[model samples]
Target: MSSNAAKLIPVFAALALGTSAQTAVAADWYTGAEREIPRDDWIVAIDAAATVTSNSSAFGAVTATIAPVNTLLDSGPRVRLQGVAGTYTYPGTVTGQTVRGVQQEGSVLFGYEWIWQQAAVAGYVGFNVRNNELSILDPGNPVVGTGIGGKVAADIYLNPTPDQFYAVNASYSTQFNAYYVRARAGFAVFNGVFIGPEATLLGDDFFNSWRVGGHLTGFALGPMKFSVGAGYAYDRVRKGGYYTSIESRMAF
Candidate 1:
């Protein structure tokens, strides 16, 4: 349990630490002929589907957050920090370009969250930025340094009830690279164990895709909050391919 909370620390830190108006951010390569592929040609992963409200005008992002209203009324503000990394690969074709590329991303999330004052659920807001690394897969080709991008998200949800969120508020990233908007729901099978599925709509460049995944989170572990999620995305362009990721968030 302690290890799980450690995984989510970075995500909580990027909270208010994110941007405004809008910020968007994305991933690896599947196919391409040019060792020098344009940013647009990059395959956007199918993870996020909706736009958010916590972003700034810098990167077409929205970080929307609704005040929390606790059903128990005892619910109060929650704070946290999180950090994470991921790797992805795909196929592409670049004219006059080369097919030598690799990508890596990581970020820190920090912010405050709690049950909405008007709703029974919960939500949070924060800032986040990711360092993207691009490289030449060819041993003989020169490896390009990693590129940089930014991201931010502020959102509110109906916490996790038997049914998905009765209501939700969120933001999305569009400019940086790619992001998504989604609706989430789940159920608790046992003590300190919750599992549910989420549906996501990917951002631009990346083919639009749908995702179904589950998360496991616990809030009773003292001041330490921990959660992890796994999901698969179905692509419109790749009938047999899917996008998958595991994420965790924690509060200290």
Candidate 2:
């Protein structure tokens, strides 16, 4: 096996071990508590993560989102608003130069969730507004545009044994010159704790990327929950790249 492929084995194993060992109280919000699923009339959440390529170039972003009503349950639909900011650093097409790019975006989404005997599904569609700064070499130029995006996610808590569950989540977005899709899956190893694989396909006309990796998710402390993942990436036509990401959510 190539050295890079071999490196991922240990990382995946370690993540699995960490996930399996995370035993929380069944009453915890994520472990089939009396609530079954975590929900709130209003929720405030933040997601932050970074991805790095084999060339040492990197991309990082932070997003803050809010839900104004109870929408994650079998009840009714909900509306959400979000803001994001991120930076990208990469080797310039020209030799001996590094290019840095910045982006800021805002979006509003509306979606609904449905709950069955032991499962729930949710989906949402939204409009996005964004500002993309050109390059570190040129500080005053930015391209601004509008776009559309949507997301779909589902969770199934095992019956007879609420400690185990499976989940799938996916999202897609498109603009005048760019579009991307991301998807992930998870299976519970312990009450409220899960491990799974994830993939991403994102980029623009000038650049694109594909990545796959395993993840650990649903580590909750009170009303807060966390997730983390890492994997190798194939950037445009190049290989040997890798990426990692983490996120946290809070419901109130």
Candidate 3:
């Protein structure tokens, strides 16, 4: 991780904590009919997703959020934890041989969220640890060496009308100079189900990729929500390929 990136961690942490304190103070000021109704004392949410591309690259991630104050349905502070793993195949140094490399990452973040009737935004700052293993060094792989570094992330959701919604998720880490961003918009087709188009951009020091796809989102079964997406992907290293992904989330 770069020293400059590591330096930013303290600044972000201070800002996040300051904002949470202000929010708590403001909440206390409300009284009588102006006071917000409490929904739940706490909430825990888990999300898992996996993606596979035609170019012999695959990735999976899981994230969990613990909000002692129930941030999912209300504004509050939360602790976020995430784990990611990926494998990439590339040409080996030896002729007619291919090498598969593995990468893993874990992070913990402190964050606060603000919610409105139709929109919500959240920001997080934290530290991350990453590891990469390869039998042969491959320049085509994005994630390179193992390191501990700073990380930041943001999520936004907007519901403009009863039938339409949009969401964006982005994150950056000093480890291997990696970054990821995804945006999607959906239109309701059923009571609570939506279908939409989605796009993603991600890269690191050595590799970059973009994907354009369609997704089926907001499908609820019992207590979980599920989504599926498929699309075309283009990357500097892999050239071009197709990708498919599935994601599920549950909160309690």
Off by over 4 Å in 3: 1-42, 92-97, 139-142
- Residue ranges of candidate 1 with Cα displaced over 4 Å: 1-84, 94-101, 104-152, 159-171, 206-208, 215-231, 236-238, 242-245
For each predicted model, how many residue pairs clash, with residues at least 3 apart or on different chains? 84, 0, 0
Candidate 1 lDDT by residue in tens digits, 95-188: 3233423333343333344423233333444444444343334333222344444445555444233222222334443334456566555455
Candidate 2 lDDT at 118 equals 46
Best by lDDT: 3
What is the C-alpha lDDT profile of model 3 across 1-252, one tens digit per residue? 233222212211211100011111124354533443322322666778999999899999998877766445567797899999989886754453687789999999999977666666789999999998886765555566789999999987766665777778899998888899998888878855678889999988877899999988766665566788999999886689999998876554
lDDT values of the candidates? 0.35, 0.51, 0.71
Give the TM-score comparing model 3 with the true structure, all chains together.
Answer: 0.80
Candidate 3 positional error at 239, Å: 0.6
Per-residue alpha-carbon lDDT of candidate 2 for residues 1-252, written as tens digits (9 for 90 to 100): 233222212111211221111122336556655423212223343444555566445555554434355423224465546566666655656453566667776667776545454444556687777666645453222233344534332222322223333444444556534555666556777765777777777766466778889788768665556778888888754456777777665433
All candidates' TM-scores? Answer: 0.45, 0.64, 0.80
Which model is ahead, 1 or 3, in terms of lDDT?
3
